[model samples]
Target: METYGVWYHEVTRMKGREWMRRLTLAQKPTPLEPLTRLGELLRIDLWVKRDDLTGDMVTGGNKIRKLEYLLADALDKGADTIITTGGPQSNHAKTTAALTKRLGLHPVLLLSGKPPEETTANLLINKLVGAEVHYFFPRHPREMDDALLRLAEEMKAKGRKPYIIPVGGSNGIGTLGYIDAYQEMDQQRQEKQLSFDFEFVTAGSGGTFAGIYMGHQAVQASSKLIGVSPWLPSQEIKERIIDCIKDARTLSTDSVPLSGEPALEDLSIYDQYIGSGYAKPTPEGMKALQIMASEESILLDHVYTAKTMAGLMDLVEKGVIARGSSVLFWHTGGAPGLFALQERWSEWGGG
Candidate 1:
């Protein structure tokens, strides 16, 4: 089977089967555009894979790619309701709700944080889609997962077939989405005669990074995949990514034997950009957000893409990324998150 630029044969043919199981939601092969102005400022050949425009306004973002596979699995299992967990303003949860509603399936979101007094951003969109949302102040992050499973059981007992999706859809099944994405990217590169030295992406839940890394590995590509940590520590994100990769390998219809197990050395994760905490707006991140908006009319969310851009700029400034080397910044999309941080926007006088 041929997809994007990849001609799947043998092991890749098995991978294509996994992708064939997915239901289409995203506008496939999102634009790969040159950030000419930003590239000039940084003195590098910089480009962007616009995953932000993957879906409609509310359903747009990187999460939609994962949801295509996840929701398809839910339907295959005869699930009538979907249960997922994420932060209060999670783009994943919002996209899940939007897509689930479109498919005529119920959505139950177990969000980690206190309910806001005034609904806005993702929370507002969730309500608009009529998703049943529950909030919990967990002592540990694992508690949210626990709550999701328990809720699914309760729904099952009440005669509803519920499917549980883990936080950020960062599981073996969802990771396949990005494996397909890598193929799409390679197709674009071949068509444009572009050569990328590095590919930078945000490592939030690790599935996106894992899939991209494994996709590159599957194709034996030379470009280095650098994951910028937006939430977890570098070590933790690395572990999660490795785990996801292993899981994906096992789930594939056929295995491609490796000389040795992929190790930490095989992956590159930078955690320096995660200033303060996960959702907190860092000064550097805010500046990066402003630059994209001003120069390219591209909106980025404070939680993910902004921090990732900040890391990219910092690496360029530090001489880690050479001036003439080509770089591809994967835009994962979380622009609606900007509206969720009204107070921070006011404090920065961005309004």
Candidate 2:
């Protein structure tokens, strides 16, 4: 095992492959600190990977990791404008908007649903960064993907070199970010002499999970990786992760071959935590937000991380995870998106 420091690396590329290109974005090697309070409450050895603090507070999040590679590819292609799709209050949208602007590239967001009367949370940041947001009511999300491509073509016709990123930046190239992240975490784990029995992460787009899966398999890691999906069903999540892994494998074929691609049955994905639907807050997730904040002094957004935490808590309570097991929660960052649901805070609690 080799030790790597910080996020900075020399200009790395395999020919003109976008997946191989990366820009330094995150603070690197985020703290893998013990969550003693939460651990005691859950009766397990709980810890958190503070990826929420990957960058500055205003633009910080796990998405920055993916953007480092994705945006680098955009710049490599001489892209003046970046386009992506997400919900109206997506953290990815806000993060992309802020970071792209910092790099002097314009961001255009194709968001589902109409603009809200109150521009708060991530949406507020999108406005602050002056991101060009196109609001629409999409019956299906694929419509937004089509819109994004069309928007890119329109921009190209206008002499604006545009780059299009899929929802959540979860593509083959962006997936490389989390592969690096897994190595970083493994290095920290080796240093601390810690080995988690299970590692949990919010699986929205599946790229992050796919990258980590690839890294885990490459290293033959002992800890089991459990992905808790906030939106997609178990089967769908598995398919998306497999797709990402497939696409990512196309970019690099080094000595450490990415063997053992997870079959559908091999994946441990739980979609039960999704109470209602995508982006809708659930009672378990809402309570989880309070529990994490009170116990660990950490905020878990209701849309993603909270649901993942909720799944872990439920598993622990049900004795499925076994008592005294070591568990690590990867905080992929989405606390700002919680502000959009402030109106329902009192209804959910805080009464």
Candidate 3:
């Protein structure tokens, strides 16, 4: 029942059965540790927000922050079953299943693509959670969305209450998660009297970055917010993030409304890190993953953090981020995704 910061009104006042409520799912204020080894190597004062440690290895990840709000809303509505959709290795879907089961709600996941030959990482976690999963290859992403909606309708006809969560829990309600996260980080900054020149985070479904952006503007923080995309092109990713901010703005005044679609000068999101595409590992991405593991003894997944850290490294070295700058990387906790790409484990330019 304790509110973190600015978004307390934004989150608890949502139109629902329990208007003022939030399920305490993830650990509050994950540690912001200095990356001494990586900092010396990169010639920058590097720090990592260990959001990856928010939960256990199986269910721990950034997704839990968002799910805390979303699942709470579902429970408030008295839903008996929760329906959600995502790719083969969606952290959000895996978190949803694990937590929904914990709350005594049936989790039905509509995952993209046929089941893999070996169920690893998130897929393995999905199975362990005993979630009802259906795999398919949809011609379009919207097709999967439609499938989820139709499935919910069918469940409703069968006298079951189904609560549908969009991919990545990337909605206005879910955006509250990262907003609170950003507030927590700000609180840490004020307490430690540390000033970060650049704050870097993985820009995937857009909600996480948007929420952070919202919180950044709300608190008038001076850290330069940058997003490294693991998916979507530059323009498309910008649009998605803008849409998320807009959605959040509708629910609360904390988010600054864009006037005439202001240029994204404040928000610097780059698609260059995407390398190939989502979930596909690149040489730089793999090398970055390996570097973090070797230098800091911290593991990063090939899908998300690997590329994000890769981009941050390149920017720092290229003098774009400045050599002596203080940098912070938001580790969004998708390391388990490495097991799914087992065949290419050593293909990141390693002998």
Model 2 residue 65 CA deviation in Å: 0.5
On a 0 to 100 scale, what is the lDDT of residue 144 in model 3? 67
**What digit string (tens of lDDT, one per residue) describes model 1 on residues 43-93?**
999999999999776946889888877877787688889999888999999
- What C-alpha lDDT, on a 0 to 100 scale, does residue 58 get in candidate 2? 69
Per residue, candidate 3 scores C-alpha lDDT tens digits across 183-247 of 89988987888899999998888788888888887788778988998877877777777777777
Q: Residues 175-214, candidate 2: write the lDDT tens digits.
A: 8888888889889999999988999998898889988888
- For each candidate, how many residue pairs have backbone atoms clashing (under 3 Å)? 0, 0, 0
TM-score winner among the candidates? 2
The weakest ten consecutive residues by lDDT in model 2 span 1-10
**Alpha-carbon deviation at 155 in model 3, angstroms:** 2.2
Residue 179, candidate 3: alpha-carbon lDDT? 83
- Model 2 clashing residue pairs (backbone): none
- Compared with the true structure, the alpha-carbon lDDT of candidate 1 equals 0.84
**Model 2 misplaced regions, further than 4 Å:** 1-10, 15-19, 253-257, 349-351
Off by over 4 Å in 1: 1-20, 253-260, 346-351
User: Which clashing pairs does model 3 show?
Assistant: none
Could you tell me which 10 consecutive residues in candidate 3 have the lowest summed lDDT? Answer: 1-10
Tell me the alpha-carbon RMSD of every candidate. 4.9, 4.1, 4.2
